[model samples]
Target: MRVKVNALILISVFALSSCKTQVLPENTVQTDIKQVVNSADVVLVDVRIPEQYAEATAKDAVNIPLAELSNNIDSLKGKKVVVFCNKGIQADQAVEILKKKGVDVYDGTTWKNVKAIQEEK
Candidate 1:
């Protein structure tokens, strides 16, 4: 038997294939980020590996690897989540994944820099 690729599937495949996987510098407003962190309803998650995170994740940051994000949706929903990976690709992907699930998300590089911003306040 032969199978045909539907137009929607083809379009989706092309769309995702064309999607950029690069990690850009964060554009999430810092002032708003600080406000949200103070709200105690936000989660700053380090999506890198445990070893990397154990090296130095932020004060309130949680270490939940990117590959496991789907399994931990309940912990991410209905809150502001700042996701960070080693350099940022995984974090960007996490932001997209969470946004699709109706979660408010941000993509910062890592807890190190994010903490700098928080400390500056």
Candidate 2:
């Protein structure tokens, strides 16, 4: 009887833990990129390599590769910055770095997404 009850409790704990979903931190909440992109107070940053950015990037986006992002912090100061890359993976990483440094930043995902938001204006 004791073994059976212990097994049931273990199963219940596993079930509850498996059902949990990961939640993003408060600062990582989704922002209204469409509206924010159009504002003059916002700066759009392309975290892709220069070659990738030169090929195609959102209008008015400044190319700052992920490796060089930290070096350009001063340039991004005093503005709402939106960072994007080819697939957004780097952008997510960039957002975390900027957040630590007290920069007002958002994960704009892909440069294509930022361009789409601009075009909708």
Best by TM-score: 2
Candidate 1 is scored at a TM of 0.67
Q: Which residue runs of candidate 1 sit more than 4 Å off their true CA positions?
A: 1-34, 37-39
Q: What are the RMSDs of all candidates, in order? A: 10.1, 3.4
Which ten-residue region of model 1 has the weakest summed lDDT? 24-33
Residue 1 in candidate 1, Cα distance off native in Å: 54
Instruction: Name every residue pair that clashes in candidate 1.
Output: none
Candidate 1's residue-wise lDDT over 1-121, tens digit each? 1235577787899999999877744543344655654456778999988999989877788998989998898878777788887777888898888877777787766676677767876
Q: lDDT per prediction? A: 0.77, 0.91
lDDT of candidate 2 over 1-121, digit per residue (tens): 9999999999999999899788987756876778788888889999999999999999999999999999999888778999999899999999999988988898889999999999987
Tell me the TM-score of each prediction against the true structure. 0.67, 0.76
User: Any idea how many clashes model 1 has?
Assistant: 0
